[model samples]
Target: MFRVDIREMLVEAQPQMIITNDNLNARVDAQVYLKVRADEDNVKASVYNVANYKLQIVNLARTTLRNIIGTLTLKSANSERGRINEELRHTLLSETASWGIEILRTELKEIDPPEDVQITMNKVVKAENEKVAAVDFATATETQADGQRRAEIKKAEGTKQARILEAEGQALAIQLVNEAAEKYFIGNAQVLRKLEAVERALVQNAKVVIPADTQLINVIGELAGVAPIPLVPKAAASPPDRK
Candidate 1:
């Protein structure tokens, strides 16, 4: 009795073609796993075509790959390898069904563009990466500049607030001093101010001149609680020498 092993088998092929979208030549290596159908009708066809089925399926797979890839640009074909493999497998299964073959799995192993195209693609990728990096760097710089600007603004505001608070404190102190003087010294505030001035002047220097009509002892006595020392008036000078 003749027996056929309907177990799945692995088939691999490399196809090279020009893409219709860009007229760019490309190559792709693919692999497919398939098995023969075990039904009596399909087995009969397999018996008749199985010898040539492998070659037919390989040729069909190559042609389908070319047709599908030819319709797509090199970029799309490279990026959508899974889709291409699935499409190729489906197309091959439809045609190979007459040979009682069932496609179990399909995969594209490698896709290669022309050397010039590869170089151009690499340049494109590099340029895109550089553009993204430049954008990120510019954004970061702007953020840092904004932070610095805000910090400077905050510092300036803080300085202004501090100066305003200090000025307010000084004004309040002056107001309080004036109020105290008005309340406690009554109309003699001017006399009290003069006494303060004299006190300051004495602290700065040892010698002081007293006005002729002023009572130094009274002023000193009021501030220091000390006994006053009387001053002697000078004798009148003889009438100016004869004219």
Candidate 2:
């Protein structure tokens, strides 16, 4: 009895140089999992429809990679690895359909640029990280400065309000004192003014002339708590002259 091996198989595409859409040379590799369907018609097709199918698969994988990756830049190929693997599997499945081959899964392994290109990319990534860090630091610093400025403004406003309240309080106190003085000491203020004038005149040793009937004498006597004495009339001299 003739037997055909109809089992799942692993095919690893070796690393190969490819030119990307941006004209950069990169080495790429991948792995494809496949199996031949075990039905009678698929078995016959797998036996008769293709010769040395493994080699055909390897070459097809290589050519398919070139066709797929050629449309992408090196950066895109590196970033979209899953997409590349899916596309590769789909293409292989369509091309090997007549051979009764079933594509199970595919995985893109690596896409490596030149050593100098890798170095440059690393440096670019480092610079980008540093730039982001610097922007964050500047934003944090500006935010802190803004907070401090707002706090200072609030503090100054509070101090100004406190001073304004204090000044208003002082003005109110002065108004209250003036109202009390006007209510209770209205006449006393005039009396005190005259008293102050007299005191200044006396202190300067100035001589002051005053008539006997002047009210100043009564004012001095009242301040000293003394009553004035009334004079008695002389009636006896007129009676002696008449006799």
All candidates' TM-scores? 0.78, 0.76
lDDT of each: 0.79, 0.84
- Backbone clash pairs for candidate 2 read none
Give a tens-digit lDDT track for model 2, residues 1-243: 547778899988888999999998999998888888999898888878999777788889999999999999999999999899889989999999899779899888889998998999999999999999999999999999999999999999999999999999999988985775575447667644554476577789997543353344555456558765444667775455664
Report the lDDT tens digits of candidate 1 across residue range 108-216.
8777888998899899999999999999999999999999999999999999999999999999988986775676566776666766677789999857665543554
Q: Provide the lDDT at 115 for model 1.
A: 90
The lDDT leader among the candidates is 2
